[model samples]
Target: MDRRLRSILKELIQAKKALTSKFIANINQVTPRTTQEDIKKLNQQLLSHGASIQSIKGRGYHLHIEDEQLFRHFLTTALYENKDQKQIPNTPDQRVRYIIQKLLLTMDYLKLEDLADEMYISKATIQNDMKLVREHLSNFYLDIRVKPNYGIRIIGEEMKIRFCMAEYLIQRGSDSNGNIYDGFIRLPKEQTDFIKQTIIAHLEKQHMTLSDIAIQNLFIHIAIAVLRIQNGHPVDNDANPKQEITHTKEYKVAEKIVGDTEQELGVIFPPTETSYVALHLLGTKILTTADIEKNQDIESLLDPAIYELVIAILDRIELEMHLNIRHDRDLMINLGLHLKPAMNRYKYGMNIRNPMLESIKKNYQLAFQAAVHAGVVIEKYTEVTIDENEIAYLALHIGAAMERQKLKQGPKRCLIVCASGMGTSQLIYYRLKTKFNGKMDIAGTTEYYRLSTYPLDDIDFIITTIPIHEDLGIPVVEVNAIISKDDLQHISSYIAGTPSNVIRDFLQEDYLFLNQSFHAKEDVLAFMVSEIESDDLKRARFLESIYEREKIAPTAFGNLVAIPHPLTPQSQQTFISIATLTEPIPWTTERTVQFVLLLSVKKNSVEDLQPLYEMISKLIEHPESLQKLMQMTDKASFMSMMETLERL
Candidate 1:
C-alpha cells in the first residue's frame, strides 16, 4: 500500500478508464517487469473487497469494483483518518495480496524459489500467496496464467485488471516498523546491486556518501514523484520550471543500473518501472542548497524574479560568511551558523540570549529594505500598496524605475492628446481603441481642427498613435498606423524622467491611524449582538468574553468609517457582524464612525485574524461610497447593499 500507488489508482478510477502499463510505468518510473508484478499484487488484493482485475489478451489491466462508493468509503475509513501512517485493512489475505502486488511491480514473473528466498519461507508459503490471489478472483473468469517462459501473467478483461492494480498500489505502504515514505522498496538482489552501483558511480563525482537503505529510499521518492505527476498531482519540487539535464541524465543512469541488476539476479526490472525510480532518486538527492547550485543553472533557466530572490539570499549569506557562496557551493557552514544558535538557545531553555542574531535573521521585511538600500540588484513588486485610483500613478513610477534599471515590463499605458476640435483626433482615438485594450489609456484624444481648446491635466506620458500636425506642447512619439513596441519603449524612457517626489512624499506621510479609543466590554458586546438574531445569544456571550480579556481598539479610519475588533479572539468561528450608529457618534474623541465591523473569534484560533483584517481593508477602500452605504434607513437594506460590494 504505497501512498503514490493509492493516489494513482484513485486518479485512474476518477478518469474511468483502464490505463496501460506503459503509461503507469512511465509515471512510476518503474521497469515494465515491476509494473506487471505491481498490477498482479493489486489484482490479488482487490479480490477480497469484491473487486477483480482483468487483462485483455493484448491490452493492459483494468480494475472492476462491484461497489465504487463502498470501496471509496472503505478506503477513506482505512486511510484518511490517519493519513500519515501506512496501514491497510486487518485481513491477512489482504496483507499478503499487498506484499505480492508490490513485488509483482518490481519483477516480471517472480519464481516460487525467488519468492521463498525473499519472504524467508518455504515453497508451500509462496504457493499459498498465489492461492489467495486466485481465491479473490473466483467471482470473475480471471486466472493467474503460468507460462514456462513468462512465469505468471493475469488473463481476463483489461479494465478489471488495471482497476484492481491501481487500487492496491495507490496507498502508502507500511514498513515492518510502520513507517511511511512515499512508497516501499521491494527490490530483488540483482536490481538492488545495480541501483547501488549506479548511485555510487554518480556520488563519486561529488564525493558524497549514501548507505544502501538511503539508495532504496531515494528510489522510492523518485517513484512516487513520477506516479503523482502522471496522475496530475502537484509535487513541491516540480513547481520549478527549469529543465534539469544533469539531474535527468543521472536518473537515466539509475534506470540502467536497475535494469542491469535485475538481469544479473535473474529477476525482471521491466522497462516500465525503471525511469520513475531513477528520476525521483536523482531529484530528491539534489534538494540541498549546494546540490541545487551545483547542478541547476538558475541564471539561465529560472524566471528573473525567482533568480533575483536566490541571488539576494546568496548575497546576504556571502556578506555574512565572507565567502562567494555560489548556488553549488557547500552551504553547511552558513546553515549551521543559523541552526546551531537556535538549537542551543532551545536546549538551554533561554529566550533572551540570542537577541542580535534574531534581529538580523528574524525581521525579513527590514532585511529586504536593507538589501534595497545596499544597491543590491533585484526586482521590486511593481504594484505597491496604494489607493485604487493611484495605481495608474504607481504604474508610471514602476515604468520609470524599470527603464532606469534597464529591465523589461510588458503593456505600457499611454495617454493620447491633441487639440480640442477635430476629425484627426477622433480618427487616432478610434484606431488606438480598436488596436489595444484600455491597456493604453487615451487620457484625451484631442482635435487638430481647433487651436486653443480643452486643457490636458494630469497626463503622465503621451503616445500619438498617429502623426501630429503641430507639436502640441508635450513629448510625443509619432506612429504610422499602429503603436509599435519600440514606440512604447521610447515613451517609457521619457516617462521615467518625470519627478517622483510627490508620490514618495504621499507614501511617507504615514496614513495609518494607530491606537485610538477602547470600548467597554458589555457596551461593545451589546452593540455586536444587536445585529444578530436572539437565537444567537451564545455567540453574543462569546464575543463579550473575548472583549473582557482583550480590548477592542476602534480606529477612526477617516472618511467617517470605523472598524472595531479585538486584536485576538476566543470564539469557535470568526463572527463578522456589522454595527451602525443611528447618529454620527464621535469614536476617537475626534473623528466619528457611522459604519463599524465587529470581528470576534476564539482566542486560540489567532490565525483567523488576518482574513478579517483584509476584508475590513477592502471594505473601507472607498470612504465616500461606504459613508453612503451606512446611511441606509434599515439594517436589512444596509446589509443587502454591503453584500453587493466586492472584497479585495
Candidate 2:
C-alpha cells in the first residue's frame, strides 16, 4: 500500500469517532477527492484482508472488520514489511521524524543517497531533511558529524545519545507497559512486561505510588539501560554517588527491582545502574495527602535543601506573579517532596517524559507560566536547565494549589427567588444545585413577596425566575423556570469575576497605543514605561523589572502577542497598557511580537486578576483576533475586538 493509504488506514483503526473526509485530507495534506480515492483504493486492497472502510452518511468514514484474525495478520504483515519496499513518508515533517528515529536507532553512518533511496526521495530532499535532523539532535546535545567519502553519524556524549534514543525511538501515548517493539529498536514485549510488573509489585510492597506516566518512564529507563548495558555501554562507575539517594528506602526498592530484572533478563547490572534506577524512583514518586498523613514526619523524609528549594520556588512565583500560593502548606510540602527526586534526576542528566505536558500547558496556562518562573529560580540555584516536561510536572503542583485556593474561597452565595408555587420553586432550586453544585451555595429559596423580608447580608447574587425590580446591592440574574445553557454561562461569568462590562473598565484610551514604530524589544519597553504616568524612579525600576522578568523567560507567548510585566509590583494601582507595532519585532528567536500588553499590578493587592489574564491568553492563542485588532486604527475598534474575545 502507498503511504497515504497506510496513513488513512491507521487513522481509521485508531479513531474512536467517525472521521470526516476533510479531517483525513488535512492530516494527509491532500484534497477531499484525493482522500476519497485513497479510501476506495484501500478498501479494494482490504477485501482479502477481512477489513473495509465504511462511509457513514452525514458523518464520515470508519473501519469495519469482517474477520479480526485476518485483519490482525494483515496489519502485522503490512506494518513489518521489508523496510526498503515499505511506503515512504509522504511529507517533509513525516520524513524529518523518520530520519530522527532512523539515525537514533542505527549506529552505522547513513549516506544521503541511501536514505533518499529508502524513502523514495531525491538526494536534495534528504539533505534538506538532514538540516532539520541536525537541529532536532542539537536539543539533545548531539551533533551530526559527516566523514568525507563515508556518511553522516551522530556524535555526542553516550548519556545524551541514549537520552535522545529514549525520546525519539519510543512512540508516545502507546500502551501502559512502555513497550516499543513496534517502533525502531524493538524490545521484547515479554521482557518489558516483566519489568513493568516487577516495578509495580515492588512499589506496592514498599507502599509507594507512581502515576502511570511515571511508571512508563521508569519502565523505559530500565529497558533502555538493560539494552545499553548488554551492548557494553553501562553507566560510568567513576561518577560521584548521591549519598541521599543511596540511603533512601527507594534505593532498596530499586535494588530489588534491578536484581529481579537482571536475573530474568540474564544481564548483570553495576552498582551505578542500581543508583540510576533509584534516581528514577526518587524522581517519579507521587506524594499524595494520604501518604503524608500516614507518616506524620513527612517533612523530615525530604532533604533539607530540597525543602528550602521548594520554599524559594514558591517565593519567586509569589514575588513575580503575585499568585499568593507561597503559604499553601500542602502545595509547599508536595512541591518540596517532588523537587527532591527531580533534583537527583537533573544531577544525573536524566529526562523524565511527561505525556501530559502539552495538555498541562494548554489547560493550566497560568500555572504553567508561574511554574516557568519557578523553573528559572531552580536553574539559578541548581545550575541545570530544566526541560518543559519537568516544568509541566511542577505546573501540576501549582495548578492544584490554584484549585485549592478556589475551593478555600468557598462557593458564591446566591438566593433563588421564584414567584410561582412551591413545586416550581423546588424544581428550579434542585436544577441549579445539580448544575452548579460546588460552584454556588444556595442561601435559601424564597418567594418574591418575602424576598424583602429575608436577610441579604451574605448574598452575593440573586437568581430569580422573574424580573427583580427591588434595588439591592447584589446583582440579580433572571432565568427561565428551567435553567438553560445561557443561564449557566451567565452564572459562570459571575463566578469567574468577569462582568460583561468589565473589559472597558480596565482598558483605557490613554493606555492604548496603536501602530507604534519599535525596532527593538528594549525600545518598546522604554516607550511603554514613558507612557506610564508615574515617578521617574518608579518608571526606571519598572523597566528594569520587566527586563529581569524577560531574563527569566521571554513573555512572547507566540501568536504575535507578548505580555510583559515586572518581576514585582512597581505601581500603587494596577493597569494595562497596549501597543501594536507597524512591523513584527523579534521578541525571541522562536516568537515575534506585534501586540504588546504591559501589565502592572498594585503592590500588596489581593484582587482576582483571572478575568484579565483569561482575556489576554485568548488573544495570545488566536492570531486572527490579534490581526483584526492590529488593523484597527482607534481605541473603539480595539475595545470592540476585546469585547468579542471576552465573550468567547
Candidate 3:
C-alpha cells in the first residue's frame, strides 16, 4: 500500500463515522479526485484482508470490516512491520524517501526497473523522484552514482552517509501518531533494542546525561557503524585517530558500550569506530548539574562565554522585540544549559532534531519569532546558521519566559452602553461578566445618550448595542440588543484585545495582490517590492535584507505559505504585503510556495505582534482557509473569510 493509502486506512479505522473525500484530500494535500482514486486502490488491497473502503454516495467513504481477526492481523503485521513486499510507494515524496532508505540500507546498487517494480510504480515516476533524491543528498555532500550494467548506489563519505542515515532512519522511528514506519532502522528489531538499552545502561552507570533525541542519534551512529563493519566496509583509521580520544571520559564509556555489544553479538569494533562513538558522546553530552538548586548563581556555574551568549540574546530580544524577558534568570539558566550541548552539536556538524518544530512555530509564534532573532545573534556570535529545529528548541525556553512575562500584563478595560434602558445595560454587563470572568475589566454601564460623560481616555473599548459612527480614539463593538451565543463567540475574538485587531491593523487591500503570474521566488519578490515602492521601504536595502534572511534559513513554512521578512527593520511602519501566486513555485528545495507574505517591522517600534504571527501560522496549516485565501480575487471575499473564521 502507498503511504497515503496507509494514512487513509489509518484514518478510516479510527473514525467513528464516514469521512468525505474532500476532507481526506485536504488532510493529504491532494485533490478530491486523487483521494477517490486512492480510496479505490485501498479498497482492493483491504478486501482480501477482510476489510474494504465502501463509498456511500452523497455521504463519503466508510470502512467495513468483515473479519475482525484478519483485519487486525493485517493492521498489526503489514502496516507497522517491515513487510517490504506488501508496502509500496505511490506518492512522489514517498518514492523519494523509499529510494534513499533502500540505498542506505543495502549500501549497494540495484537496477532501476527492479526498484520501480518493488515500488509498484512506473520507471518514469522513479526517474522523476531521483531528481529530488539527488538534490536532497547534495545538502550532505552525498550523491548517487550509476554505472553501465551496474545499478545506482549512494556514494559519499562514511560520515556524511551516517548523517544522512540518522536523519532518514532513526529520527523517524515513529511518526507523530506513534505509527511506526516499516523498519525505520536497517538492523533487526531485537538488535536495535539491545543497542538502545546498552547505551542507556552505560550512560546511567556513568552518570552522563543525554536527551532522548541525542540518545537516538548516538544509537543510529553505533547501529550504522556495526552494520558497515559487518558488511566489510571498514572506514580504516581504527588505530590512527584513536590516540586523541583514548584518555577522555567519554572514550571510557564508549569503550564499555562497544565492548558489551561486541561480546554479546560475537563481533569486534574497530578502534576508530570506538573513537567515533566518543565524538558523538561529546557532541550530545549535557551537564548532570541541571537538577541542582535554582538558588545557586547560574553565571558562576556556566562558562563565561555561555553566560554572555544567554544574556546577550535576552538583551537583544528586549531591545528589538520589546519583550520584557531579559531579567528572567530561569530563562537565562535553561537557555545557557541548552546552548552548551547545542553549540557542541554545531561544532561537530551534527544535526539536532526537534520533533516539536511545527507545533512550536504554530502555537508559540511570538516566542518562535524571538528565537529567530536570537538565532541571528547566535549566528553572528557562533558563526553557525541556526536551523528551524534548533530555533524550535530555543523557543521552548523563550515561550516559558513569555508566559511568566504575562503576569505583568493586565486585563482590557471595557465599558458597556445600552440604548434600550438601564435594565438592558445591566443585563448586557452581567452577561459579559459571566463570559469574560476577569478577561476584561468592565468599568461601568451607561445609557447611550450619556456615554460622553464617562472618561474615554482610559477605556480600551466600548461594547454597545447602539451604533457609534464617530471614532472615539478606541475600538467599539456594536452587538445586537439580545446578544446570542453566536454573538458572544464573534465578540470573543476581539473583546479583550487578545487577538489585538491583527487583521485590521496590518493588512491593507492596497498591499494585497491576487493570482499573480510568477514562476520563481525572485520574480515574485521583485514584483511585490515593485508594487509597493515607497520611501518607507528603502527598496534596495529591503530586498537585500530579505534575501539575506532567506539565505540564513528557508522561509517556506509549508502548506504553500512563505513568509519573507527583512533581516532588520527597514521601514518606519510595521506593514505586511501579501501576494498569492497563480501557480505554486519551488521556494526551497524541500518546499513549494503559492502564498507569499512579505512582512516588515518598523524600526525601533515596540508592538505586540504575537497574535499576528499566531494567526498567520494557523492560516498556513489550515488548508480550507489557505485555499480560500489563495482563490480570493477581491477584498470582500477575504474579509468574509476572516469574519466566518472569527465565528468558528
Residue-by-residue lDDT tens digits, candidate 2, 1-648 = 767887788778866556767656655656789889889999998989998889889668878999999999998877545434534677666787778777766766888788888788998888887877887788788999898778888888767878887777776665765567434666787998899999999999988888777788788888888888888877777763646578888889999999999999999989888887887787556667676778766457567888778878888888767676888878888787678768878888888778787567556767877888888889999999887888888899999999898777778899999988899889888888888899889988999989889999888788999998766756787888877888888777777677545567567888889999998899999998898776623777889989977766567765567889886778866788999887777686435678899888777655567777777777755544556677679888888878888777
Give the local distance difference test score of model 2.
0.79
Residue range with the least summed lDDT across 10 consecutive positions in model 3: 173-182
Give the alpha carbon lDDT tens digit for every residue of 194-266 in model 3.
8888999999998888877677667777777777788776665732456866898988999999999998776
Score candidate 3 by lDDT. 0.77
lDDT of 1 at 616: 52
Question: lDDT score, residue 330, model 2?
Answer: 83
RMSD of each: 28.0, 9.2, 6.0
CA displacement after TM-score superposition, residue 613 of candidate 3 (Å) = 2.2
Error of 1 at 116 (Å): 27
TM-score per candidate: 0.22, 0.66, 0.78
Total backbone collisions for each predicted model? 66, 0, 1
Worst 10 residues of 1 by lDDT: 505-514
How accurate locally is residue 451 in candidate 1, as Cα lDDT from 0 to 100? 25
